[model samples]
Target: MKTVSFLTKKLGFGLIWLLLGLGLFSCEPDPIEIDLPAHEPKLVIATQVFPAKYMVVQVSKSFSSLAGDGKEMNADTTFLKTLAVEHALVQINFNGQTETLKHVRNGFYVSRNIPQHFQQRYTLTVRDSVSGLECTAATEMLAPVNFEKLEPEVKRTEKDTTVTLHFTLADPGPERNFFLISLVGANRKNLLPKNKIGSFNAVQEQIILVNHGAFTNGKYEGKERLTLETSDTLLVSLSNISEPYYNYLQLYQKSGSLMNQLTGEPINLPTNIQNGYGFFSAHNPTAQVFKISER
Candidate 1:
């Protein structure tokens, strides 16, 4: 009789646990619905003008982030082609003269006749015939600041050889100035005979930014050290850019990767284009090349 009582209690406890498990699994939360606001597409433009160089402008269209599948967007050639704004009228205005840019392939517009003048304001106007969207922006061409001197020191170690380039730049004046320093690597074999080093295909690049506040005594000095191989060639470029473009570059650099775009807060980059997105600016650049020794 006692054994029968024990079995009965055991079975009762088992039934109680089974019932609790079933009740827990049966409860399901209701689905949630969020009402997102409507999105409007805008025109996007990007260009940089240089003295004695042809002006080229690239135009495209922006789209809603939620319009496509929830995958990360890859800016491949095929995808970029779709975003290109075709049949657009692009023009540049300088000193009461307007030069219409000729459309090249894939939303690129070019004009070689419009000469870029330092400290002169140039206005860009872009009108898309298909979407009836127009945008205008103006920027002054900043003067090119050349490097005063570049002194390279080579340090050889058992593992590798590194070159340190010391550079100097004289401040134009007490007025505020912004500069961008770029260091890029290229293949020595890809250099065309009698061609400039800047024309070589760049493999990798690093950037250094300098603002007016960093200058002292009418001059600024900086250094960059890089480990180079035998087949590598380094190109150093200095660009004097406008303050607006400098702010734009700073915001762009702070924008995180695609994953951050999806999960974190969205960052709005600074743009000068009116009624559109993106930046239209002018800069002057001077570049020099450094060859690696085949030790």
Candidate 2:
């Protein structure tokens, strides 16, 4: 009787183990197949015109984010050379005159004859002979806004030094307007060693955009703070930008996320170009240089 009882318990345990193994084997997952659409490359145009400066247009081709190993896209020389649209017919038209832009180097087109006048409309036309693609865009040059007053105050501590900038500018008029404020700091000649102070050899630039209709009192006042060496030179610039270009820039900055690119999600950035995928705009910047003084 004892032997029979033991055998019965052993058989019950064996049955349970067999059922568990079968259940595990039956729960295996099946592979799923997804159908992704083919992607076609497009022409990307980037051009910013300033008064009295030659208009340089950068033309390049956009590729699928999944083309190479999943890495962030870098605009290095090799990458630019690989994706540059070369030998393209680029032209700019303004005031009943059309000027052809010369292709300087890898995807860059230049035009020195196009007059950049305030409120004058300029049209850009680009045709790629190799790809049989054509695109066009139009933009008006915006006038520069002068700064009313720019004052800097410095505060130094044992750890770091901070400079506070106070600035003001008059509004153009009741008409809607957008502005971009830029600050650049460069090392002065014969300054202290770069190691003792922070490296100021490379120009550090900070830019901020003022939204349209942000000011109502016909005047704009703002303040910015920075950390820099005592002998650094600072350049402050105020630029009046068009509404469309401002929108484009705002969207462009948002869409520059690495995760967004890696996911292959489509983002339609605001573009003035017809049948293309970039922006063409013009602005004149009023700038002033200042020498940093100890306080």
Candidate 3:
């Protein structure tokens, strides 16, 4: 009888151990679900000052991603028109003088005059008369970059012969410098089929263009070597950009990368506007035309 009791007790303990093992090793946790609160709308201002061009500022409001319905909203013309602020009082101050910008159409405000020189410091102020909200930003325009050499080298492959335009840029610096190299075809055609567009610059032309990339005076300060793969009649615009603009462009490039999306990284842009969201920057652009050989 004692042996039978002992065997029963051993069986009970084994079952308890098995149950405990299952509880410890085989149990799955319940997924966590967090409900985030909605976000508020903010004023967004954007502008870029370039040489020999009147300043144009775009004013708009940004909607919070969490405020809308479950369906994603597309930023169409109607949506854009709704966000546009047409009656904002925009002003620019420079050299102890202030000028009110004229509201053109949509949300764009244009200055009456062009930038005098590259070294002038300009201040931009935007006030929403309805909401009593104001935003201000400042930037100094840098001198335009001069290319030492721009020539094309042709290489014949088994499939096709390709031409690469080689560029040599000299950085004018005692201070840190940034540059943008923009290329546009005369006929408004793309250089390549799958060419990607670069970061946004407020400088716009009547014709469509493609930007190579934003470059900095890191190692190639004296004469940097750059190339563009093309065989079309291209217009190249090189601009010396302000530091804040440079920083913003760099942030944009990183945030726009596919790696950032793959890693689930938040792409929050760095804004230079005070009491607002967006950036106002200055740059000096010099353009030239390059004609490549016909294959």
Candidate 4:
């Protein structure tokens, strides 16, 4: 009698044939198809009306998220055509009086006789006849506030000297206020935020306010201190913005960087336009010139 092992030649051949048969019958899965709905465009308006100045309004249509890449490579001609709302009727209503704005070119509307009174409410109306879409928004201009222009305090050290400027004002009691401080003519490409201060630099050597930096009547009383390492002629503009404007800026200021968008949650900008996008705000700015010299 011959002894046979459990792994016999016939059984090994049978298992190999079974696997080959299964492999021959297997098929790759089909790709999934997704059908997205069409996107509707909304009106976008960016207008800032100030005292004793011509009202300028920029009208455009909001783009869909699924639209073509918003990048600007060989898209100069078509980009301009796509963003502008060329055939829209714009108007400004002030204290129950309406004035039609003239379309000067490329979706820019201008009005010479706009009421720019302080504490006055102005209404903006935009109508697209082809799409029968209309958008309206209201904003009130704040009265300009007075601030003290004091000399900068100089601090000397063994390595370098630091110049600090102080701006002080009596905050309007009981009412909330937003302030933006900026410096220009510094003649530097960048500014490093020193001592954990949230100061940001703009082109043309301007420094903007940061850190949800706001003041109320009780605490700061509209006092701001600016410190710089080098000395230059600084032109400062302190703007008193509305609450809605403040919220908008604060949101953007907090989450405006590309790093924040890449690593953190998405940020949606706050808009006050009814049936539209973008912000319509009125700000009162008081400008002063000063020289920051190191001692």
lDDT of 3 by residue, 1-295 (tens): 0000112226778899778877898665575698845544456777755555677898876654333321223324565577778879999888888888889987899874855666788888998787666788887766666666665555776986454556766555565656666656522223333436433222221122212232354224222122334446666677766656666655554342221211111245666777676677766567877565553
Q: List the residue pairs that clash in candidate 1.
A: none
lDDT of 2 by residue, 1-295 (tens): 0000112326788899778877888774575698868756666788866567578898877666555432234434465477789979999998898899999988999877777678899899999999887889998888778888888776777987667788887887878888877777732222334326332222222565686566647777877666565457888788888888788766554443322222222666677888777778777788888777634
* TM per candidate: 0.72, 0.73, 0.62, 0.63
Kindly give the number of clashing pairs for every candidate: 0, 0, 0, 0
Which ranges in model 1 have alpha carbons more than 4 Å from their true place? 1-29, 67-72, 151-163, 186-205, 226-231, 257-266, 293-295
Sorted on lDDT, best first, the list reads 1, 2, 4, 3
Clashing pairs in 3: none
What lDDT does each candidate get?
0.69, 0.68, 0.58, 0.60
In candidate 4, stretches whose alpha carbon ends up further than 4 angstroms from where it belongs are: 1-30, 70-81, 130-132, 150-170, 182-236, 254-267, 289-295
* lDDT tens digits by residue: candidate 1, 1-295: 0000112226778899778877888765565698966655567777856456678898887755454432334334575577788899999999899999999878889888877687899999999999998899998887788989876677888987767778888888888888887776732222323534332222222556789888888888977555454456777888988888788766554443221122211346667888777788777678887766632
Give the winner by TM-score: 2
lDDT of 4 by residue, 149-205 (tens): 444565778996555565565565565566655565442233344535344423223
Looking at candidate 4, what is the lDDT of residue 183?
61
Candidate 3, poorest ten consecutive residues by summed lDDT: 256-265
- Candidate 1: worst 10 consecutive residues by lDDT? 1-10
